[model samples]
Target: MMPRRLILAGAVALGAAAAFAAFQPSPVAAREAVVYKNPQCGCCKGWATYLQRNGYKVTVIDVEDIEGIKRRLQVPDNLHSCHTAMIDGYVVEGHVPVEAIDKLLTKRPNFTGIASPGMPSGSPGMDGPKEDNVVKAFGPGGIRVFGTY
Candidate 1:
């Protein structure tokens, strides 16, 4: 009778352990961002800092010819900005906010990338409040609203 009781107790403990393991949350993989900007661009640095603070592993690359990079990446002339970033196989242009980027990642939309067009004063990295800011997505489907900040 004693041996049977001990075996039962061990089995219960094992079951509990399995349950705990199953309920544990899986670790999330860190996302990597690579940003390209002009060598003397200050706003670009600010944008990179914003990304770092928002849980993205950011790598900023300073280049002398930003236009060449944009051309290589096929960024539209209308969506040109001071900086460009590559994250999770998406292109981010200009002073796009972190919130917009989050939405982009979550939706996983079919697009070449998203852009803020120009360096808006009230953007993530630029000076001023983030009011009336809009980010647009560009792809084979054409330009569409991505998010508003």
Candidate 2:
């Protein structure tokens, strides 16, 4: 027969494994983020910090010319931001909310990515209030109302 302590330890280990398995995020779920912005831009830094605070793993790249990056990526003029980022395969522009990006990744929507448009107030880097900003998602076609937050 097994010792009581050994039986308890085995039970605990099994329970812990079950919990970890149950709590694991889906493979397709989005978790990490990467931001590309001009090295001199303070707002871009603030935005990266914001993403970090919200449980995102952010990689920041200081670029010489954000416009060049934007043009190379083919981001539309109206969906422009001070900085541009690529997370997973989608292009995230401006101070887009992390939650929106989460949804986009989970759903794997048929679009390019989310854009807040021209550094609107209350965005990630641009601070004010959640209500003060309106972020939109864009695609090859045009802008679509993804969400306000």
Worst 10 residues of 2 by lDDT: 126-135
In model 2, the Cα lDDT at residue 144 comes to: 85
Candidate 1: segments with Cα more than 4 A from true spot: 1-26
Tens-digit lDDT track of model 1 for 8-31: 999999999999999998586568
| Number of the top TM-score candidate | 1
Model 2 lDDT on a 0 to 1 scale? 0.84
For each candidate in the order shown, give its overall lDDT on alpha carbons: 0.89, 0.84
Where model 2 places Cα greater than 4 Å from the true spot, the runs are: 1-30, 129-131
What shift in Å separates residue 73 of candidate 1 from its native position after superposition?
A: 1.2
> Model 1 residue 83 lDDT?
97
lDDT of 2 by residue, 22-73 (tens): 9998874436887889989999999999888887788999989889989887
